[model samples]
Target: MNPDDFSRVRSLWTHCGLPSRPNGRDSEQHIRRELSDNTASFLVAVDPDETLIGTVFATHDGRKGWINRLAVDPRWRRRGVAQALVAVAEAELRRNGIEIIGCLIEDGNDASEQLFVTLGYSRHDDIHYFTKRDRPDI
Candidate 1:
């Protein structure tokens, strides 16, 4: 999406009652670089007037592809924008020779969980999501 679409994306998230973390330093340039490079890709859904209604980000880590921070504008929900984004990301990953795409969805987020399943993703058992920060010593 174009730089002008950030306002729409921001508004969409706000309308969804979610506070997005700031893009963290030189956001526009970073996004442009990502879209131009092999490292990352993002998709956005825009209305007839080019106002954004949804967005998702994907990254290639030299081994597998990962999708994260997917969101759809609440006002524009259930219109297939999110689905399209996922499709595009998967296609790109496949093109890059990525054998599989993995997404980490919070356990209670039914919609996301279902979307991945519907898209042919299966959740692997025996692997639970755990986090560890840089700090050590309890």
Candidate 2:
């Protein structure tokens, strides 16, 4: 995504129920940084009127490809926008030599789970995910 698309993308994120963190990751700086790192992995889909309808962000750390922030406008859900975004991102990752691609879907989010499953992503029940906030203790 380009700098010009930041505000629309941010608004879309909010509309799709994705939280915005205090860190720079949720800022324009972060979007610029990620796009600079890998432009092809950051994509946005728009309709004929040029309104942002969908978005997906993917990145690779030279070992594994990670997909995140897959959001589709509520008015456009179940219309193949999310699937198309994933398909393009996965293809880009594979073309860049990434062997493993993974996405994290929150528990109870059955729609996302089904989308991934329908796209052939196998659930790895053998592994658990842990996280640490980058910010310091209050």
- lDDT tens digits, residue span 31-96, model 1: 666667766777787789877777777788879999866788777778888888888888878888
User: How many clashing pairs in candidate 1?
Assistant: 0
Return the TM-score for candidate 2, rounded to 2 decimals.
Answer: 0.91
- Measured against the true structure, the TM-scores of the candidates, in listed sequence, are 0.78, 0.91
Candidate 1 at residue 128, lDDT?
84
Off by over 4 Å in 2: 136-138
Distance (Å) between predicted and true CA of 130, model 1? Answer: 3.6
| Top lDDT hit | 2
- Lowest summed lDDT over 10 consecutive residues: which window, candidate 1? 18-27
Each prediction's RMSD to truth:
3.9, 2.2
Top candidate by TM-score: 2
